[model samples]
Every structure is written in structure tokens, then in C-alpha cells.
Target: MRTTHALVQLALALMSAPQERHWGYELSKTSGVRSGAMYPRLRQMLDEGWLVDGWETSEEAGGRPARRYYRLTEDGQRELGALLRRAESDSRFGGLDLRMA
Candidate 1:
């Protein structure tokens, strides 16, 4: 992984709920990364086999398209955790609460 700032933010966000499913938009909103940046990183994670994605349907969405959900694999937890640890050491990402809740 390249470990960009957006990737660090995404690691923090995903770590916050490792067991839960996430949508691209939700990740974008929480990580403060735009869709243009978010989706490509997500694709990278998927290609790296650190994450898996699937579709979801809910009455809550009503007429909207089925939502796509992503979840971290066991390897993802380790990868993201390592990413956060590196960020913790990097001065650029200092003082960021990069721990999982």
C-alpha cells in the first residue's frame, strides 16, 4: 500500500468498525476523502485482497440503487493496522487518534 494521507484517514475509518460493512459514500464522508479518491483506493484494497465487496438491498434506500458494501478481511486488519502505525510514526500524521474504537 502507498500509505497516502487519504489512505491513513481511510485506515482510521475502517478500523473504527472492522467488523461492519461500509459503503463508498459512507467512507468518503467519514474519511473526508472525495469519491474520486475514495473509490480508487477501495479498488486497490480490493485488488490487494485486503477487502471484499458486495451489494445490499434495503427498504430504507427505497427507490435508490442497491448499495455496494465493503468489509475488511483478516489481512486488512493487519494491513490497516500497520498503515496506522506507520502514520503514527510519520510527523505528517502526528497527534492523529489512529486507533480503532
Candidate 2:
């Protein structure tokens, strides 16, 4: 992984609840990333086998259509660890002190 800031942000967001499914909009909001960019990166992560996705349906959602939810795979957890380590050591994030939560 390239370890860009956005990537780090997304990884942190997903890793926060690795065992729970998350909506894209919620991820975007939590990560401070816009949906326009978040969705594309999410798709890429799915294709790279870092994330598993599924549609969630709920009648309580005001009859809204199902929303796609994503969670990290085991491989993704390992990848996230590596990515966080890299980000912590990278010059670009030197002042950020990135750490797994």
C-alpha cells in the first residue's frame, strides 16, 4: 500500500471496528473524507481482498433501500498493522504519531 494520508485515515476508521460492518457514508464522515473519494478507495480495497462487503436491509430505515456495508478481512488487519507502522515511520506523518487503537 502507498500509505497516503487518506489511506491511513480510512484504514484507521475501518480498523476501529474490524469485526463490525460499516456504512460508506459513516466511514466517510468519521474519517473526514468525502464520499467521492471514499467509495473509490473502498472499491479498491475490496478488489485487493482487504475488505468484505454486503448489503444491509432494514425496514426501520424509513423504507430506504439497502446500504452496502464493509468490514476488514483477516488479511486486512495484518495489512492495516503494516500500514500503520509504515505511516508512523514515514516522514510525511512524522508529526502525526500514528498509532493503532
Clashes of each: 0, 0
Against the reference, the lDDT scores of all candidates come to: 0.88, 0.83
Over 4 Å off, model 1: 58-61
Query: What TM-score goes with each of the models?
Result: 0.90, 0.88
Give the best candidate by lDDT. Answer: 1
Tens digit per residue, CA lDDT, model 1, 10-79:
8888989999999888999999989888888999999998899998867756888889999999999899
Q: Give residue 40's lDDT in candidate 2 (0 to 100).
A: 81
lDDT of 2 by residue, 1-101 (tens): 46677788898888888888989889998788888878888888898899999887686465788888898999888898788877877888776546667
Error of 1 at 32 (Å): 0.4
Candidate 1: which pairs clash? none
Candidate 2 C-alpha error for residue 41, in Å: 1.1
Best by TM-score: 1
